[model samples]
Target chain A: MQEILQYLFSGITNGAIYAVIAIGFSMLYNSTELINFAHGEFVMLGSLCMVTFFGSMHLPLVPAIILTITCVALAGLVFERLAIRSVKHPEPIVLIIITVGASIFLRGIGMIIWGKDAYSIPSFSSHPPLDIAGAKLLSQSIWIIAIFLVAAVGLQLFYKKTLTGKAMEANAISKRAAWIVGIPSKLMVMMAFGLSTAMGGLAGVIIAPITMSSYDMGTMLGLKGFCAAMLGGLGSLWGALIGGFLLGILEALGVGFVSSGLKDATAFLLLLFILYVRPGGIISSADVNRF
Target chain B: MLLVKRYRSMMMILSVLAIACLLVASPAISASGKKPYKIGGIFAVTGPASFLGDPEKKSMEMVVDQINAKGGIDGHMLEAVIYDTEGDPSKAVMGVSKLINKDNVIAIIGPSRTPTTLAVMPMIQKAKIPFISCAAGNKIVQPIDPWVFKTAQSDILAVAAIYENLKSKNIKKIGIISVNNAFGESGKEQLLSQAPAFGLAVSKSETYGAKDTDMTAQLTKIRQDNPEAIVCWGTNPGPAVLAKNIQQLGLDIPLYQSHGVASPKFIELAGSAAEGIMLPTGKILVAALLPDSDPQKEVLNAYTSEYEKKYKSSVSGFGGYAYDAVKILAAALKNSNGDKEKIREALENTNGYVGVSGIFNFSKTDHNGLSPEAFVMVKIQDSTWKLLQ
Candidate 1:
């Protein structure tokens, strides 16, 4: 029972991180009809930049983090201008291929900058594990979960209150309609890419203390996050949150109850089961086609 | 129409003649005295395992430069053809083919990580080129492939070393958490097979994937088993994550790592969590700390100093693996004078060649040439390796 509880806690912590990545995927899919496959590289750049600017350059953590996010956001913008915008007309498959190419390009650049070493980010706190009943949770994990919640809520509020966020939503509804209303749909798509990457970067910096940062770190993680996004119905934000946790918990339980080797398999198998049951995601309803 | 047919036939004849001319000139160019004894290197100079490959490349380059400066092998300038495998098996295949077919290398040095070494060894053996590996895996040398030799001690030696220490502590039951890769799988096989011989039992074993970010779930399962110690087998990032997860869980068991994580990069990635984790590794790590009378001390010391001085960076055990491999290859080269068959025979008969790793003694049956004595168990103390008594 204690072991079960322990796995549960760890699962949630990991789920939160995956949720963060999935949310970025969901956000981009929400505003722009295309998914940025380079989303994971944004995460990699965030933590790698922090390791350089914050850890190596010995800057204050706050400014280092800010600059890291700005760098990652700019990287996302570059991907947009160079790869996405250059496509005269893009099908979904074409967009995916372009974004994956951008991902590889970013990874190559990361290799040059970081020299293929796995680097670490020191945790925000050095305290011992907080014992929740019989299960122990790292304070860094708590920070991860808290940060995920804050980001989710903050995004929610921004989408509801801000004009730019509304414009993004308008573009998502119909690009032609948004352009007719003078919303500048193309800029909205670019901003969605930028905002999504910023969120992904934040996730990377926060979780990198636990998972060390490397140049190719984003490939598998991006795959998993994409899984969570697809499971949650790509068009739904809340679906991403629930789907991330679901994938994380199922994977953890698989490790605990079933074979540890089958954790990834178990998660994918569950996705298959869910897809069989509901074409839309767990939180996704029949009418959740809008942003 | 007749003119066009005549022109096409002439072009085809010219192309065939060109190909025949190139093929006819290849052997004469390769056999020349100026065409130095070529050695090809396939290391993961960039990508996930660059920590291992990058160092190996630098060490090989250093060794090559030193050998040439002292005057080339048998007065023939030594030429090295190196290809970056990027830790991929297919890249290793590509590189090895190019070396054998194009570069005309008589010897192949490394494909730094275990899987790449395994992938390319059979090819080298078939080609009858003397292949020396720098990775640790018993399977690399197990079947007695006559053409292949390894510098780094095998995983069998690592398992024995860890079991030796565990026996001293009187620990009977053990747990293992190995990554799901060739290196970890090989380590797990040795640890399980060798445990019973040393009066130990593997109680529970868990595994993680290559890119797993969190190991808490697996570690938690291992913790529940309540074994004497948990042996984590993997390379960087995975094992480092294990250290952090173990620290976070406050698991009180003594952690033992495989030689795979026996480098400063492990400590750097693991951070404070690395404190007190013990592992068996090559003496390159503790060369400075070795007593004067130690057999490996002088060679390790000289190699580390020269490498550190040349590269302007700290030496790693991975680099020492390549350094040892090249030393053995150079010894064989000196004995055979770059004859491929003679080099293979010479490498097979090598005896008491003191390398940075250990004293190598190759024989008809044993290509690995080192034993359990090659490994020195060290513990991470204050974020650096300390020789465990």
Candidate 2:
């Protein structure tokens, strides 16, 4: 039972990261209707940027994280204005291809910059194990869960209460209507890009301390995030949270009960089964566009 | 004046044509006189497994530089034509074909992963070029091909070493966790087949996918079995995740990992949990932990110093094995005086060639340069490896 709890805790920790990254994916897709395949590369860049700034440059952790997120967020904005804006007038398939091409291009650039070596950011907390109900929990895991929850709540509040946030949501619903109402739809779209990239950067900052940062680290994480977003209904923020956490827990349970080698396949299999049953996602259709 | 101008233009055109002809003929004439001895290197270089290939390529470059510095091999400069296999077997075969048919290399040196090496083996045999794999799968050299050799010790040898180390601790029940790749599958087979011989019982076995980040579920099942030790066989991120999960579960049992987890990145990723983990690897690593006067001491010291200076990072077992591969190949080439058949014979006849890893004794039957005697159990202590008694 204690062992199960440990697995549950670690699963939640990992799931929290997936949830955060999925939220980022949903936010961009919601506002811009663009599937940012390169979103995971933003996370990779964030982590690599932090490693370079902190691990190599010996900068203070706070400053390094701030610089990483800011740089990555700016990169997202640039990517939007430069690469994505050009394709906005094109078909959705063309936009998808552009994003994927951008993903590959960014990955190549990351390899050149980071030299294809794995790097780790030192943990924010002590490296000691914490005893909880006869199971050991890493201090970093606690930080991961706490940060994810805080970010989720903060985002919920921002969307529900803030004026700028409402304007962004209005833009997502219909850009023409938002523009007619003087919401500065273009700026709102760029803002959404910045917000999503920042969230991905934060996930990178937190997860890099545990999973060493590599140029290709984004590939799997990106796929999992995409699966999570789809599972939750791509535009539903709360659904993304639920979907991400559920997927993580199911993967943990699958690896425990089923073959460990099939853990990844199990998640995809579940996604397929869910899609087959609902034809949409785990979330209700009425709430599909509730970003 | 017009005739003179025509003459000048014709002279210019003729000079340009003469230069182009010389440029085309120069390389052919050079090639016609004496062929450059070509060695093909197929490495990952740009993929998920680039970590392994990056260091291997560096070592290859270092060896080539050292050899060239000494005025070439047997009066002819040795040229290494490299192809990136991208850690895929299909690409590895393509690389082998390119090397054999296009580059016409005398020998091929890798395709680092076991699957890639195995994929390219039939082609290597068909082409009759000596193939030396740097991967650790025991089956890589089995049913020994007359033209194939490997500097990597077999998984059986490493697994036997693991069992021996566990047996010394009187640990009888062991759980196995491995990746589903060829390397991990090979390790699983070796462990299951050899555990009974070592007086150990298999308590449980679990596997995880290559890209899995959370392995807590598998660790949970293995913990339920209450095995004396958990044996993990996988590369980087996977093993690191396993160690983290074990720490999270607060499992105090010893964890015995494969040499794949010997990189410093493992400890860095696992944090404090990496301590007390025992892994069997080539002795070339943790050489400093061995007794100072040991027979392999001098070689290890030299390699450690040179590699540290060259790469600016602490060397791992992969680097050590690569170093040994180059040195062994160089020795064989020197002894054979560049005769391809004689070089193959000399490599087969290599006996008691002491290296940083172990004393290699290659024979016609066994292509692996070392036996089980080559592995030493090392425990991670305070982020550094300490040789186990």
Candidate 3:
């Protein structure tokens, strides 16, 4: 029972990280219908920026975090302005390729600035593990799960309750109609990129202390988050959360119960099975029915 | 007048071409008027394994510089042509092909990781070029690939070193976790195969992905069997993450790491979690702490000081592999006299050559040229290495 609880905690912690990254993917995908393969690099930027601000520059935690998020969001805005806006044809495939190119470019720049060594940031508050029924939970894990919940709930409220959020969703549905309604569709697209990258940055800062940060850290993460997003149903906020958690829990349980060598294989095989059955993903099908 | 006006432009062009030729040829023409011997270096200088390649490249460059400073190897200057493999097998193949065909290097020094070394091995053997790899894999030198040799202590030796340490503590049961990559797979194989001879029982052997973020589940699973100690085999970040995961789980078993995480970067990445972790490593890290009676003390000190002074960073055992490779090649070069086959034969006959890693004694059947004595076990304490007795 304690072992199960421990696996659950591990799964939930990893799930939160994946959810954060998955939301970043879903946000941009919803607004622009573009996958934004470079979304992971934004997370990389966030973590490395925090490493510079908090670790090297010795800024206090809150200020370093804010600075890191702002810097990465600005990078996202600049990336959208430069790479996405300048594309002669904004075909989804073409834009996806451009983001892929942007990821390589950003990674190169990161390498030049930071080199290849992994850098760690101190946790926000250092404390001994909290014992809950004999399962150990790091204080930082609580912070990560809390942030994940906050991002999900907050983004959910923004999309459903606020005018700008609804406007963004409207822009997503029909760009022509939204433009006719004076919704400023271009601004919404740019805002989606900004908001999405800001979330990515948040994930980076929170997780860096645990995972450590390097230039190429985002490559596998971005791929994993994309899988999570696909598993939960792309463009669905709650779906992303459930998908991320499910994937994390499954992976942890898989690692624990099954062979550890097949950990990733287990998660991916489940995803393939789910995709074969549902086609639109676990949550996206519900979303499609509403449309 | 017309002839003079037309000829003036021609004279300018001729002068420019002549200067370019001299500029290109100047380095090739050494002080002794002898051609420089081009040495090809393939290192993963800018990737996940950059820790290994970065230092290897710098050390090779440092060795080349030191050799050239000493009036060349028997009046023939040594020139290093290094290509970054980025830890990719295909990239290594491309780099080695270019080195063999385009660079026309007399001998090659590296392709820093085992997989890259293996990827380029068949080509090296076919090219008949004397290749000295800086990667640690028994396969690189085992079964005697004549043209292929390696400088780093093989995985079997490192495994023997680790097993010796475990035996000292009388740790009978061990859990093994390794990253599922060439380096980790090789170490895992050695760890499993060599266990029986040491009277150790392997309990719960697990593997994690190279880029895995957490190992709690693996550790949690390993905890069920209740091993006396756990051994993790991987390079930085993975092992570092595993350390943090172990700390979070509060599993109190002694954690043993492979030499893959032997650098100070491992400590920095792992933070306080790195405390008390033991690993077998090349002697360079604890060079200053070595006793005067140690045979490798002088050579290790000289290389460490030179490298630290030049690079403005601490020297790693990984870098020492390249340093030894270059030194070994330089020894062979002195007698080879620009002949590739002679270089091969000379490398085969090298004996009692004290290097930063160890005193290498090469032969026809044994190309790795170092014994298990090449490794010394060290423990991390207070964020620094404590040389174990």
Candidate 1, residue B363: how far the Cα is off, in Å: 0.8
What CAPRI-style quality would you assign to candidate 2? acceptable
Model 2 stretches with alpha carbons more than 4 Å out: A1-4, A53-64, A127-137, B1-34, B334-342
A best-first ranking of the candidates according to their lDDT comes to 3, 1, 2
**Per-residue lDDT of candidate 2, residues B47-71 (tens digit):** 8887777677666666766776676
Query: Which candidate gets the maximum DockQ versus the true structure?
Result: 1
For every model shown, what is its TM-score relative to the native structure?
A: 0.93, 0.90, 0.95
Cα error of candidate 3 at position B55, Å: 0.6
Model 1 chain A: worst 10 consecutive residues (lDDT sum): A282-291
Backbone clash numbers for all candidates listed = 0, 5, 0
lDDT string, candidate 3, B1-389, tens digits: 54664465355446545643432212222344688899999999888889999899999999889998998898888888888888999999998898899989999999899999999999998999999999998898888888998989988988999889999899999999999999999999999999999999998899999877778888989999999999999998899999998988888889999989888899999999999999998888888788999999999989988998998988899899999999999999995788999999999999999998888999998998899888899999999999988
- lDDT of candidate 3 over A1-291, digit per residue (tens): 988998899899899999899989988888888999998898899999999999999999889999999999999999887678666568999899879877877887788789888998777888888999988888989989887777778888888899998999899887999999899988999999999999999988888888879999999889889999999998877778888999999999999888899999999999999999988789974565211
Better model by DockQ: candidate 2 vs candidate 3: 3
**Per-residue accuracy of model 1 over B1-389 as CA lDDT, tens digit each:** 65665565455446545643532212111233554788888888877888888899888888887887777778776667778888899989988999999888989998887888888877886899999988778788888898988888888889889999999999999999999988888888888889989999898888899788898999888877689999998988899999989888888889999888877889999988899999999888888888999888888888988988998988888888888888788888885777899999889989998898888999988988997888999999988889987
Clashing residue pairs in candidate 1 are none
Better of 1 and 3 by TM-score: 3
